[model samples]
Target: MAPPTRACKYGLDCIRNNPAHFAKFTHPAKLVATRAAASSLSTSKKLKNQKPILTSTPNTDAPPSLSASDDNRDFDAEVVAATHPTTASIVALVSTAVAPDVLANISGVTPIRVLADGDKIAISSYTIKRTHDHYYCTCPAWSINNRPVDARTCKHLKLVFGDAYEAARLLWKDPFGNAPPAPAIANKPKRKKQEDKASEDEDEENDANTKKASSTKAKKSKKNSDSSSSASSSEDDDEGTAATKYSAKNRAKREETKLKMPALLLAQKFEPTKTDPTGWWISEKLDGVRAFWDHERQEFVSRLGNLFTAPDWFKEAMPKNISLDGELFGGRGKFSETVSVVKTNNSPHWRKIEYQIFDSPSMASQPFEDRIAKLNALYPSKAASFLSSQSSLPSSSSSTATKNSHIKIVVHEKCKNLQHVLALLKTVESKGGEGLMLREPQSHYIGKRSNTLLKVKSFYDAEAIVIGHEKGKGKNSTVTGSLKCQMASGKEFKIGTGLSDALRIKPPKIGAIVTYRFQELTNDGVPRFPSFVCERIDANKPSDAVVCILKKD
Candidate 1:
């Protein structure tokens, strides 16, 4: 008999169990019914094939096909084990009574339900299989993880079975020993509910007691069911989802490799009066979202180590062996558009974005001059002496270059004098450029902020805590009018400028830190004209350099 290819609309909820209904459309629970019925006949030739559930006798030489609501309740053991599959169920799977290889295996089973794979969530045509307590995904995201084999998981698994199951699937070393029942499953509540919490401690205590008391009884119930098989593991998922939530202590027992935090170089404020621009590398400071490419993981991560899910085509163009420090840019003054695209998972808008490479972390030991030389040699690039070659008329921005390439080396020019830098700064600012960046000659890239690298913006920028919100006046009254923020120095101010219509309507949360730009500081230590830049996702708290000063840059 052939397998059913078309899907039943009602699926698991369908009550029809007759042969006619089974042949017309497939149910995940009855996938093996057709094959099992055929095989069951060759073994016994006694039990009639009216019902497909019971294909074998209890005492048959063939593997016992699971029984159901016919008469006895004894055959529901596998269903019970699968529905609320806990740490105890995993132990019973590997116990001495069962075959050594018959533990936590679900590869032969069909998927819980059909899901189309591609883009924002699932992987197209990717295979996810589990065998004997270990999961394997053929997707690039899963393969690129540096974690151990048992701990590896992809978005596909998280999308289908969920994060709770993945967190609790770690193996038990003592399979033969009595195992405790797994704690009840529950995901963390929303932010508002979490902020107003009281009963969580009591719930955790009750779960701890439940696991301890039910351990031995749960362990004693495995009936040499390695040879005992089922049609589908997805059937009882509605009521059988066990260990969905585990206590903090229980989650601590799971295996994981800690993620390595990136060490990126920071910039300092350019003091034109003290710092000389006569013999340094000058480049147009791009107002783009910052990103660091980790070649080991084959992905882009923030400075704080949160992974960015880029499209497969976008990442394929990048080098798999070398690390890059740069920003995801969409030309000059396209900061909002670039951030919106980059924040989305597997966004199609990624094609519009270009990776602007400025420095290489791998070449940090080498001199800055030598690093630029390497970049020029490897890429079709614009040289650092670009300013003198062409006038500032043709927007030092990009062209139809992204059609053929995904990366571009930021062009740098040799600074002539203080007057020349000031003239170029005004020109760039007029053309909607952020400002200019000055790098000292022969300077090595270091992780911390140093005088070697400087940002020469006309306005001062800093971060502040989003402490409160004030309602808008007149037409804007329905949305947030202004945000009341506090500086690290304890000075508070209101910023109602530089906010987009979309942001003004929603606004950043109370505790979130946002970057703001100002002209200068007042005698009271407050910013004279504070304006919002954007909310910061990399850091929750502001650095001491908030409201950073620069004299006539």
Candidate 2:
């Protein structure tokens, strides 16, 4: 005969109809887990509640590497009931994380999951954190169950990673093999535990991390005592302050270590007579999202220092040792499509995209020619045959791109003269290209805008944040007519000229960074005849490029 049916780790929430699941675990009707439900649990299991501390955010330069050093934290949804008194209190909720959408938008990077054989999964319905090894769930059964934290499992986790995955993680001998994830810069995941088990982890997990930040109340007590000039009293008197700080967005009180901004080269406009083009490197200016590849951390960071979550295979195709500065391009006239794919977290649409490299930030000290040569040398042998000939360029230069068959070298040719520059511009623009970029020979890459790199465009373009929206007039009266936008310099304007019907009906989210084109800036430094182009980098914060009154889009 088979062993007694065990209580499902999810209790009643275990909605799996899989005969496989039903054969192993039984759903308990009551909140109190029955013998069959928690048969595997140790009755004498102890709650490993440790003092919670503030966790920092990951470096802006790269995503946290997938290691196994105890990174999984459950910053679940708003709790349903008050503290059980018997168990740890749900004293706080996770604050909104920075660019969390980037995580969610990526197809399968998050912890929220579904039962593949059970039912369709709605990832947004739950708040879960599934790290490389650790897993956390908000379900009361898992949180308050009489089991070791390392041994804890839930139906939610089973769904996200699948049954085989969840099983292997629980069985791993070194659960915390992943490196310490900087907690949350924006939100602090509260520590909770089973009725008789450790609050965060089984034994080693919560105790190790908590000992580092042991007394949250004591920390708050000292802070309040220092700040209280009007009223001073016992450590117990600051309960309200502790509760307030630990309850919400103000919770993460770790050292304020800001994300290090990446230094990258910017471009200036080409002046026909003023700037010389003879012997300069000329290439087509791709209309795609600008990204900096941080090889050390293995992630794609955007121009203003935000993440663009590319799929694993997409990143795998890139060079591993050197850092790169390039554009995530789809094709000419496909700027909006490219942004849509890159901005979404771990999107498969990435297959349609390519990392068209222009320069290498790692080789910033080297001349532009040398950087191009370095990129060409690292090019994979799988490069397409139908690419530009390297006969005119250094023998190191390759023709096309593809490792997983993505990532390409932006073809660069030396400018012979002024006519060569204009003719190239005409060719690119005629074929629906953005324009041409001219790089000065032997110029070392600089982070700041300079004459070393120049863009040739028919019309000027800049990015602005969407502040509000206004309804249309006349025939388009029902839909949105304009997007009220603001620049980094605090100047505001409306973009209504180039909006399509789809965009008009559903305008970009307020505060979205949108690209717009114009003839020139007004005397007051406003765009003239501005037309909407597409959405750009969006972190829901003030635009750093707002100061770029004429910065090319």
- Tell me how far the alpha carbon of residue 132 in candidate 2 is from the true structure, in angstroms, after superposition: 30
The clash count of every prediction, one per candidate, is 5, 24
Best by TM-score: 1
Segments in model 1 whose C-alpha atoms lie over 4 Å from true places = 1-246, 249-258, 382-404, 460-553
- C-alpha TM-score for every candidate: 0.42, 0.41
Model 1 C-alpha lDDT per residue in residues 453-540, reported as the tens digit of each score = 8888787788889899999987788999999998888877888888889998889999899998875564356775578899999988
User: TM-score of model 2 relative to the true fold?
Assistant: 0.41
TM-score of decoy 1: 0.42
State model 2's lDDT.
0.53
Worst 10 residues of 1 by lDDT: 190-199
Look at candidate 2 and tell me the lDDT of residue 533.
86
